[model samples]
Target chain A: MQHALILIGVLIAGMGLSVEAGLLGPLGEQVGHLSATLSIFMVGALLLSLALVFTPNRQLGTLFKQPRWLLTGGILGPVYVIVLTLATPLVGVGMTMVGILCGQVAASVAIDHFGWLGSEQRRVDGYRVGALAMILAALWLM
Target chain B: MLLPFIFLILLAGGAVLAAQSSINGRLGAKTGVIESAWLTFIMGAVLTFLLMFFFEPAHEATLFSVPKWQLTGALFGVVYMLAIVFAVPRVGTAAATVAVISGQLLMSLLIDHFGWLDNTVRPLDGSRYLAMVLLIGAIGLIYLSHQQRHRRMVNQPG
Candidate 1:
């Protein structure tokens, strides 16, 4: 029951990306692609900051001391976007997306198998591979 | 020559991305979802601004030059960020990541077929229909695996 809801939540989040991509293109065209990309983070930061201010008991400072590497998430976010932008024009969006999806599945499986980044160990067996194969094949067609 | 290298980089970048989601999900479960999200956005904002200053070429229009409504698009990012942070802790990173990808591909096909939001019209064909079927099959398989796991755990003793 709980897992289903989480699945829905991530799905909605994924759908939001599609919408964001739609908006981002025109915004990029208007403000310049890079600047528009900046605006996403800027605006999101501002909004989230306002949200954090109102919410009580934020442990922001505590997070800094946990492990420096954990903070790489922030850095990775922008780097992924920049790399995608660079890859898109050169390889075409279809091929670029296929590459990313392939990477995502491989990395996810490895991370799960090794329990990297504190994720629980979940072995990739025939079932997982079959599902992933379907996803990759679908990605190729799309 | 360079193309393979670029593709390799993309693959690495994609790996780090899944890593990033898992890391942020850990942070979210610890520091709070909004806090984790805020940190990433602030850090991203600063980094992108620096890149813009040093590397990005000048363009004809600025953010203010565009329609005000267009800016709301960034909010969707907040949704995506928060969703990953919230979902990853409950569901494993692999499940959450694939689910998100499934959602993205599903909606993207819709957008392409309809030509919504000023995108080029690319009507769906047979392969596209098959893609949707296979994509759903993938999601279903994942869900079934989760169900099997849950049943196994339930049957086991503490």
Candidate 2:
């Protein structure tokens, strides 16, 4: 039951992403693509800072001392969005979306299987593969 | 070679997204979601600003030059970051990632069909409908398997 709710919540978040993409497309035309992306991060950071002031941040000393590799998340987020924006024109949206969906599922499965990055191990078995195949087929149809 | 390279980058980009979600989720669990989100955004904001400043060519229209409504798109990103940070810890990365993709596909189709936000109308067809159904099925399968594994872990005796 709890899992179901989380799934729905993420799904809705995904919808918001589509809306973001739509809004950014025209903005990108006006103010350069990378600049548009910068706007997103700046705005997000600004909002999160406001949120922190109200909520109070957790211990900062602990965060800084953690593994340096963990900080890569900040870089990864922008890289992914920028690459997708760049690739869409070259490869077409359908193909680009397929590549992204495939990569995400494959990486997610690998992460779960190998227990990388502190996630629990979930094996890459026929069941998982079947789900992946469905996703691929779905993408292909789109 | 160039085509393959672009595809490779796209794949890497996608992989990075999953990794980011998983990593950020762990960060959220440790430092609080807002704190972790703030860290990534601050870092990302700085890095992208450099990229924009040094690499991006000058344009006729600036952010201020454009209609103010366009800038609101940035707010949705906050929604995505917050959602992923909160979801990943509870539901594991694969499930959350797939669910987000499913949502994207569904919503994009709607936007295309309706020509919302000035996107060209790409009328929905049978294949699009089928694609949505298959995606839903995929989500259902992933969730069920995830539940089974979770239950097994909970029931295991020490």
Candidate 3:
């Protein structure tokens, strides 16, 4: 039952990501790149704020006091959006996403194994390495 | 032109690393997704604002001039973040990512091919489908390997 729930969650997340990326292509077409990006982040910020207000889990202080390691991760948020937007114009959304996914999976393996930036380290072995390599090769082929 | 491409690659790499870092932080200690997400956006918005101030004056100027309809992209971001928090643990990162990419490719094809937003036409073609297949296969293989590792760990003596 837990596994099933997880699978459903994965599908929902995937669909959400896809829709977001899809919207980007069109949004970029309508608005200039910077405006599109700023708007998305602004809206995201607004939505998250609203979620915090309505939900009891609002830990604004905890989030503010986050360590440098976690704070560093915040940098990626905007950078990712900007990159995806730029890449869409250059390589098209499909290819750009392929590149991003390749990078992401590759990075995920290391992050999972070593737990860099103050993360909890996990076991690393041949299976993990091989899997990541295969994914990279597949990205290249694709 | 090349600069933007380079920046994009760097940004993608950064985002991946950042995500993993966040997960690691969660595993190591208690972390609130909403709080973390809010901080991330606030910081990101500030950073981008600064970058705009220093680098591209003309582009920055146009940002305020745009109509409200252009802000629709934000709705997508809200959905995407919600999906991440919900899906990452259940499906594993690789599988969940592939699913997202598949959705993106399909949607992008439709939008690009038809110029759905009154933009230039860039029809979907063979290469796109081929890319999707590779991503799916890659994700499947990764998950299979993960299962094997889990089995090995279980079989090992404590």
Candidate 4:
């Protein structure tokens, strides 16, 4: 029951993210995409800090000790948001999402196959391959 | 071979996002989810500031004049990440991702149809609806694949 409730939260999180994507594109239009991304992060960083007041586990040193590759997740956000803002006006949000999702699913397959970034390896079996094919077909249809 | 540079850019966006999840998951395991999120947000904010300062300095004098709702993007972003952080542990990551993408598609359809946020009006035609439906089906396939792998492992005696 707890798990089911968590899944519901995940779904709402998805909805919130979609709303963010929509709002951010226009915010980018008012400001620049990169600037808008920066603003969002700046604000998000501040808001996320409030979380620590409750959890209160200061590990700034541990964060600094991580290898460079693990830290790249920070940089990836602007790349995704910047491109999203730029592409939305050109391709429209619908196709832009399709294309992004295609890339995401494809990358996920490779990541899972190789167990990159410390995930458990899952071999690329027939079911996995078929899923990819279906996703590609879905993208094309979109 | 329809290789549009635009699509490629978006593709890269998705790939980086998937990679971020893996990296962030490891970081979360160590520092706790919200703590790691705070660190990543700091990193992202710092990097974006440097990039924006150097390469793209758009005028923000209008920022104060803009409606308050335009500012909610940041809040929504935080909520989204918090939800994912909380949800991924209970539900599998793939399922979480599918749920996110489903919400994105449905919302995108509504936004595009109404031209919300000044987007060009794109009617929700048959192809668009079919695509959404097919994507949902694809999500089922992903779950089935995971189940198959699980069953195979169970059948094999240690």
User: Which structure among the candidates has the greatest DockQ?
Assistant: 1
Q: After superposition, how far is residue B67 of candidate 3 from its true place, in Å?
A: 6.1
As for candidate 1, its clashing pairs are none
Docking class of 1: medium
Error of 4 at B138 (Å): 2.1
The digit string of per-residue lDDT tens for model 2 on B1-158 reads 68999888888978988899999998888877887888999989998998888989999999878888888876888888889999988878888888898998899999999999988999999999999899899889888888778787899954
Question: How do these models rank on TM-score, best leading?
Answer: 1, 2, 4, 3
* Candidate with more favorable, higher TM-score: 1 or 3: 1
Fold similarity of candidate 4's chain A to the true chain A, as a TM-score: 0.76
Summarize candidate 4's per-residue lDDT along A1-142 as a digit string, tens digits: 4544554566567777778877876777687778778778988999887767766656767876777677677788877877776788898867787788978877767777787777667777776676677667766765
In order, candidate lDDTs are: 0.86, 0.86, 0.57, 0.73
Worst 10 residues of 2 chain A by lDDT: A56-65
Model 2 residue B110 distance off true place after TM-score fit, in angstroms: 0.8
CAPRI class of candidate 3: acceptable
Assess candidate 1 and give its TM-score to the true structure.
Answer: 0.95
**TM-score for every candidate vs. truth?**
0.95, 0.95, 0.71, 0.82
Candidate 1, lDDT over the whole model: 0.86
Per-model DockQ against the true two-chain complex: 0.79, 0.78, 0.40, 0.59
What digit string (tens of lDDT, one per residue) describes model 4 on residues B72-110? Answer: 788878877766655544444555566566666667777
List the pairs of residues colliding in candidate 4. none
lDDT of 2: 0.86
